[model samples]
Target chain A: MKLSLGPLLYFWERDVVQSFYQSISKSPVDIVYLGEAVCSKRRNLKLDDWLIIADMLDAAGKEVVLTSLALFEAESELGLLKRICGNGRYPVEANDMAAVSLLEDQSPFIVGPHINTYNPSTLALLSESGARRWVMPVELGGETLKQLQQARPDNIETEVFVYGRLPLAFSARCYTARAQNLPKDHCQFCCASYPDGLLLKTRDARSFLTLNGIQTQSASIYNLIYQVPELVSLGVDVLRISPQSEGTLETIDAFYHAMHSEVNGNRKPIEDWQIVDYEFCNGYWYGQEGMLWKRTDEYKNLESALNR
Target chain B: MAITPVGMKRITPELVCPAGSLPALKSAVENGADCVYIGFRDGTNARNFPGLNFSTDEARQAVDYAHDANAKLFLALNTYPKPDQWQAGVRAIDLAAQLKVDALIVADPGLMRYASQNYPELRLHLSVQGSATNHLALDYYKRHFNIQRAVLPRVLSLSQVRRVALEAPVEIEVFGFGSLCIMVEGRCALSSYVTGKSPNASGVCSPAEAVRWEKQGDHLCSRLNGVLIDEFSEHEQAGYPTLCKGRYRVNDSVYYALEEPTSLNVLEILPELMQIGVSAIKVEGRQRSPAYVAGVTRTLRSAIDACINNPEEYQVQPSWMRDLDKVAEGQCHTLGAYHRPWQ
Candidate 1:
């Protein structure tokens, strides 16, 4: 399976983002998705900059895909959609159907996770219309993946969201703007301040969810570091790692080790790869409680006993 | 346009009912529901309350009983799965496929995909929890997943819904009665931020456990996860402490923070919705009792009949529904979202 870097869902200084991707160009990831997947107000890189960066990544021997904004709230957003899909330079990930309809029947594209591609018939329909690969919706597990893969049309690659904070929902109203006490239309890009996102904790401070612009994401970062074998067995062709602000290099390296182990299946756990938080959950990957980490020795030892 | 007995058939608006319990399901079906929708007791469905939804055996039997009486049963697998809940969600789909349900109302695209893959023959209704707010998202689900019916978000006007229905591929279901969700369904994160569970992720919204009502001297203070949303005096009625419905202090005085404590009643607007090609009218009360179920269903069923029997006699008035609030949560009612003046 190939390691694909999903789009950056956060905003940062142009130089900071540039430096981060510059370092990533040297990483082991084979596919890199670029573009702002959140609030369109974050213009860290314009069309020209993104094109130049895409060219740079391609020169570095990586497959580059451009992403469209998740929520298209304005008419100008529609204009941007046409520009992105019509760029005609690289594969586009259709976050919404407007983008899909633009690319469908005309070009080969990757079906983004949020498009709701359920059932073999729908997959077949989109595949016939020229979807080369599809990232399974984020919340789906291995059993469903296996079923979809079995029924998936020929030559369409299956991808899964392997790591990062899960994008749970998007809306017309910006929670980030609301937090800053501004109406969505007149708000002056306040989401730019929070590098990761504005984390809203319960009064109990349980580290609940992250509010980014118009998107609501899971508070716990999803790390599928341990489920490499299961993903491989399910015939997943690409693993999309959604970009994060911190520990990204570590994430790439850990996924490297895990994917290597998955590919070869004859190795101990990667010792050099430091897990920032094993609080690191693979529960969603393993078909367990999403917040539960299964690799904890207590649980692993119990598994060993159950096997015995 | 004039109606006559010469017309081939009079279209009766569908009386869609909720089934939080088996008894409620039977009551709704017996009373007047042409179709009933239920969910598994787990977080697989959006209404994941303690005593609501059905167990596995109960779901199987409920479908059987609904079918025997010539009514359809729609199973709601509406909550997005936590990575761990995926397998269990698919298990629910497999069971539904085996049972041959009339439809599966799905909220999550992932869940929609799982059901579509596992059971190609089963009908698919897009749950409002899918939050397909516009024609684009609506058509995508309709075209790709072959969603046979769509429970639209409570954020559109009757005209916008008409335009969408014209462009959308399947049936359109609108909420005719229930608590008015001011915010878009499936996209709300307010409750989850203040609590560990989110409605989109955990099949709950502003969970009951987080709500606490206290007597603070002369006022009744309702707090949700410790946020003082409302303080009601003895003269006023206290409502459910949903994040959207709570009263909060904007400047100095306390007010209805997000929305006034009013439940949704679109009975007056039912003809307007039906004229706009609304296929099904939903009455939302998954946590309601069987008596309430019987009463609401019977009333809506008769209302649908009344409209068909005489279009000139069809009029929507608040007086049409007198005691619905006595049994309603939050103790008030309005035509939420469907009516623009709700703002």
Candidate 2:
């Protein structure tokens, strides 16, 4: 299975973002998506900057995709979506039906996770419209993926979220701005401070979620490294790793090593391979609760097969 | 034996009102509401806030009282459940069914399946949390899951509503007042990502505890989870802290990335809605005071009578309908998705 680096969901300095992609272009990740998929107001990097990075990654022998914002409030945003559709250099990931309507028969676009592909018929309709690839939401796993993939149109690429916090929702309301005591129209870009995202806890203080602009995410960094073998068995075309502020490169390298090796040293098993120090949970991928993880001998064998 | 001559009866659309408290329930029934929707105070329901919803004893008594007064009672079991809470939610649904709720408004398919299998006799209405904006999702619920009604999402236009009502077998309950959610309900992930508790899974969104009203020299700041969304001076009106209507700063300027604070005013369009085949008119706020419920229901009930009676003058916004400030969001109102041209 190939690895695809998801777009940067957080706001970083422009130089920081560019440098992050510089390293990504050289990494083992086969496909790299570019653009801001969240709040449209996050403008640390514009479309040109994303295009520059996309060109660099494409030169580095990687496929690049431009993603549209999940929520659009005005005509200007729609105009930009039209412009992105006409960019021609790369495919656009349509997150909303409006974008899908725009891409019908015009180009081979990607049906994004937010596009609501819960069943076979919806998948068939989108694929017939022009979807060459599709990404299952983080909540869906191997079992659900197989169902969608079975009814998938001929040659539809299937990718799944394998790492990083799961994006739960997008809205016009900015929770961070609200937390900062400002309305969404006058928000001061306060979300820029936390490069990763602010942790949200239950009143009892359980770390349960994270806030990034208008988008909400799972507190746990979903890691599916152990399920790579299951992924291979299912013939998933790509594994997506969402961008994180720190240690993402290390995580990428660990995935690379595991993807190419049956065992790390001492035959300790590839499933036992610790990719970064983040807490690992494969429950969603395994059709268990998202918070559950299984580390057994079988899981070890599964990991070994994935890495090899 | 009593035998009566058949009398012509004009069918009045059922007015569904929200009862945040017991007193509100009594006031709603007293003010001629055909039905009332409520929930247990826990996270089992969508309006799962502290000091809101109802206790078990209160819910049972409320049901009895509403039935005694010739009104129906609905229990909202709309929030999505985590794996751990699924059993508890099922228990709650079963209990409500046993209490003889007129119907249960639920969103999750798995939970709906549970209700269908375990308590087949219970009435089920798809909650707005189901986000059945398109017909197919609603058709799935009606044909296979056996939902009797569906509360349509707020993102649809009137023509879309007509199409949906015409196609689906279930009755359609629409929002007539309160906060207008800009995003598609149940399908939204924004609140859960920021606050941990989701409107879908946990039954809360842009929760009040996470909100802060910070006052600067002249402007009052409203923040949710420490993210600044809006600022108002002493001159501007204060609205609730909801994520979608908040503002954001991009580049050097701040803009309204979502929607502005506004109440949904479909009162003027009631005749159009009815003409389009809406089965029921639902007022959205169940969290407001009892007085607000009485006022809204009284005005709307009068308006519905006039519309079905005389259609000409009813086409205009009512002179008394403007008195809806006590129950509106942002102290202002709009036609919402019906007026997407303004959006």
Candidate 3:
């Protein structure tokens, strides 16, 4: 399975974003998704800036895809979506139906994870509407994906979000600004301070969620590194790794090594698991509570045999 | 209802209300609801709460009662179904079509395709859970499923709503009152992240089973699955522990980081909504009591009538406002995204 880099879901400085992609040019990831998928007010990287980065990544033998915002509220946002769809070079990942509508019958595109493709017929509709690849919604489990694979249209690739904090929701109200006692219009670029999003804890001080501008993400980082074998066996064509503020290159290397190791018949269990600075969760894939981390086989085998 | 004056014309928008049970459906129709939307008890709809919604028998009777009262009945099969549950959604659609309900409010494109292909004559209204905020999104549904109407998500500004209505190929429905969803419906996974259930996958948010309330040092702490959602002081009133309405520490201060516990009341915008060609005004709260549904339906009914009869003299009466406020969440209301400052 090929590894793809998802669009940046957080606001970052233009230079920081530029250097991040500059480092990614030498990474093993095959497809790179560019552009902002969260709040549209984050204009640190305009369409022109994204195109410049796309050219840099393209020259490095990486496929590039532009991503549209998850929530479309203004005419200006829709106008931006039109420009991205008509960019002529890279295929756009349609995050919302508005994007899908604009790209319909034009050329093949990628359906972003935000679009609900829960069943086969929806997948079929999208495939018929010129979608060449579809990212499974993050909330769906492995069993659901397995079932969808039976009826998935031919030549359409299935991608899954295998890493990073799961994007839980998007709203018109900016939670980051609201946390600072400011309205959305007066957010004052407060989200730029949170390179990986602001952590939210319960009254008992248990980490629960992350608040980035308009997007709310899971506090527990989603890691399916241990399940790469199962995902590959289930006919998944692409594994998407969302970008984080730190250790993204290491995270991508870990996943890339796991994919190759499994194929080379010398599978190395993921040890030294401090790849990112968050607790790991794979419950959504296990069809359990999304925050719970079910034990992987390596840990299960190390425990009592009866525990299995 | 339509009112014609000389060369000018105005179509009184439909007063669509929610009914989670047979009693709620009856109360809404009795209280002047032009149309009532309901869900089956089988977890196929967004309001899939335990002990709520209509059984097959209950749904058949609901259709008869609404037809008898000259009020329309719309069945809500709005949630996206997984592969195992896909057949259940199709069965619910078949049952609703067989009962001859006025329309089917749906979100999933697969289900919409199935319903349109199998039951060719049934009317389909795109549910708010469809999250069609722009004209292009609405056109996607209209072109594919031949939907008759589309409920706009609550995320749109008033001018955006007007612009969409002008360019929309289908009739537009806007939320007039209900518990405010800070996030767009069908797209939010906060519930699933915390409690393993979501409106898109399981048709519930902040499910009741995951909720627990405790009194700690004179403050009431509401927890969902051992994660505290909010803590209310002795004098402060506590609303439902929806994650968005919960207090969280942001930038070193605790506050309702997403939204305060409140209901969206658009009675003041009824005239503006009608002028912008809004075909229906929906009163949310299927999980609420029959009395709540009746009060909201009656108040919005009167508000729409006044706005239609005399647009120049239309004023939100204090009595109507008080009646709605009594049933509002957090006992507060806002114009929500209809007003620019709230966004």
What Cα-based lDDT does every candidate model obtain? 0.74, 0.74, 0.90
Which stretch of 10 consecutive residues in model 1 chain B shows the poorest summed lDDT? B1-10
For every candidate structure, what is the RMSD over all alpha carbons to the true structure, in angstroms?
Answer: 7.8, 10.6, 3.0
Find the 10 residues in a row with the least total lDDT in model 2 chain B.
B1-10
Q: CA lDDT of B13 in candidate 2?
A: 65
lDDT of 2: 0.74
Per-residue CA lDDT of model 1 for A1-308, tens digit only, reads 89999999987889988888899999999999998777777787987799889999999999999998765544566678788888989999987766777787778999888766646655776787689999886655576677788878887999899898878666545666666567666767777788887775533234545767767776677777666777887788998888888878888877877778655766545555555433455555554345445565533654455563
Candidate 2 deviant stretches above 4 angstroms: A1-239, A242-255, A258-308, B1-12
| Candidate 3 Cα errors over 4 Å, as ranges | A297-308, B1-10
Clashes per model (N, Cα, C within 3 A): 8, 43, 0
Error of 3 at B14 (Å): 0.4
The alpha-carbon deviation from the true structure for residue B272 of candidate 2, after best TM-score superposition, in angstroms, is 1.3
The residue ranges of model 1 lying beyond 4 angstroms of the native Cα positions read: A12-23, A40-49, A69-83, A96-102, A116-129, A142-154, A228-235, A257-279, A295-308, B1-15, B20-125, B129-131, B136-148, B155-163, B179-277, B294-343
Question: Which of candidates 1 and 3 reaches a greater lDDT?
Answer: 3
Candidates sorted by DockQ, descending order? Answer: 3, 2, 1
TM-score for candidate 1? 0.68
Rank the models by TM-score, top first. 3, 1, 2
DockQ of all candidates, in order?
0.09, 0.09, 0.73
